[model samples]
Target: MTPRIHGGGDHLGVARWDFSSNANGCGPCPLVLRAVQEADPSHYPDPSYAALRSALAGLHGVEPARVLLAASASECIQRLTAWRWRAGDRRFWTPTYAYGDYAHAAAAWGLVRVKEPGLAQLAWLCDPGSPLGQGESPDAVRTLLNQTPRTVVLDRAYTPLRLKGDSALSAEQTDRVWQLWSPNKALGLTGVRAAYALAPLGAQPDVQTLESLAASWPIGAHGEAMLRAWTQPEVQGWVAASRATLTQWTQALSDMLVGRGWAWAPSEAAHGCAKPPHALDATALRARGIKLRDAASFGLPGWWRLSAQRPEALTALDTALNGLALEVAR
Candidate 1:
């Protein structure tokens, strides 16, 4: 069976105002863009990726040996599941509504879904999780850790984009789980796919297993440049500044939606789900070059996940909703 497609972006060509994907609205960071453009594609990157790995490790204050790079977060998900299956894992669990790939990868590798976290061999957790943007509860994390699952992976793709709240896990607690990092979303360079994970401390054997399963040169020149840019202080500073802008935009968009009778789901991230006052024709909005993610796929029906965009884009969305309201009244 084919893997299911997940998330939203400019997949159907490009929308004039796209709120489907939760990428940083204020990026691609200028520094990251420059680095990608200057990256030389003529030569292959050092297969060992020593310098790049060290840079990332230094940024996170983790040992370079614990870092496992992949083509993207989705690829890492599949590869990790594959390795776990080979090691006799036969059940997977996701504590909350998750990215589709989590289930897809598990099923593809012959793992069945288990509702009870303690019974599962592999568990997936996303903080400031997608479609909803809420952080995982600390008590819940503690419970999961106490359960002692065979493997647990925490997807931190949205952590950097979180507009509010801290992670539920303490640093020491974080070291006990696989922390996956996908810098492209945070940098607004999603087109250049590259992601890395910091394996749990003392999981060197599992790290080695993952390394063997990986195809050499999993990341390309542009991806390497993007990941490299992610390690720079100035680039992170840019990301920090962008959050301020995103905060303002998020509030403005939420207010507009609320005023129009849409019910908003509270979120700590720059993106969130909101229910329209009435049903909306998604295709009609697409025709006008606007896109909003339907949340049914993420298990939230009657809602759409909208990313905060610039004021002009918000105005365009407001106008589109007004049109829909008018047609419904007619």
Candidate 2:
């Protein structure tokens, strides 16, 4: 735990607990950092966002008008709040990790907050987790959505960027799926928070209002440039490399966990969401200078989420975990 400098990414130093996220280090893309400083995508200094939206819209199979790019998914949560009341102490959330801030935003909106071992109206779950990279079941999701219609807002972010199985909310459907995807998280453009929403496409006023608000206040110039660069062929090459790297790291990490007599999450579901929650003791890990997020936050105390972000991090984790005695795995 360190002072998050508004956005200074020092969560990298967490030898044990990676609270920040597993964005799998973005490599030399002709798209970011000094590249932006060098060349520019300002073919139209006052460009038409249509091109950007069109690209993402086509990818998601949505109309350009349905596409609304925002600074970050957090902005989407705020926009969601504009439609839904923000406070009254009456609301709902389910077990989750790494929600940018949707539940907190809902609470801020003033409503009767309801949480528990089982109070899941609007289940805020993530398949194939944030930092851990596990996947979950669509049937499970459908069940949750069936439990409560027009209430749930699932996060289907990592499902796309990384190569994966069928996402519970990736199709051209899923009305309850209000997915917020960030290239920064999966594709590694953390600075450029250009993300899109994959909610239901329809004549809903709520969605239209959110879309209009986003268009009028789009993701800005820097984000637009980052998106353009990421969409470039050279940059996409980086994504492919990153995916391969992740696959390798994931296998190594899984092997290490198994060798240590712990269960490695299956890849069938998406990030490790299908696997049951488990964790190592923080007090013992603290002895190793490994501070972990208590899984209790996501309903599994001290069991920090771990994903094979890259080869190096996975190696480090395997080494660290291997050094531990069998007692710690429990």
- For 44-98, candidate 1 gives per-residue lDDT tens digits of 9999899999999999998999999999999999999999999999998886667
Candidate No. with top TM-score: 1
| Tens-digit lDDT string for candidate 2 (110-140) | 5334544134434456655553455555665
Score candidate 2 by TM-score against the native.
0.70
The local lDDT score (0 to 100) that residue 2 gets in candidate 1 is 33
- Candidate 2 yields a Cα-based lDDT of 0.54
Off by over 4 Å in 1: 1-3, 9-11, 147-149
Residue 113's C-alpha lDDT in candidate 1? 91
Determine which window of 10 residues in candidate 1 has minimal summed lDDT: 1-10
User: For candidate 2, what's the RMSD?
Assistant: 5.8
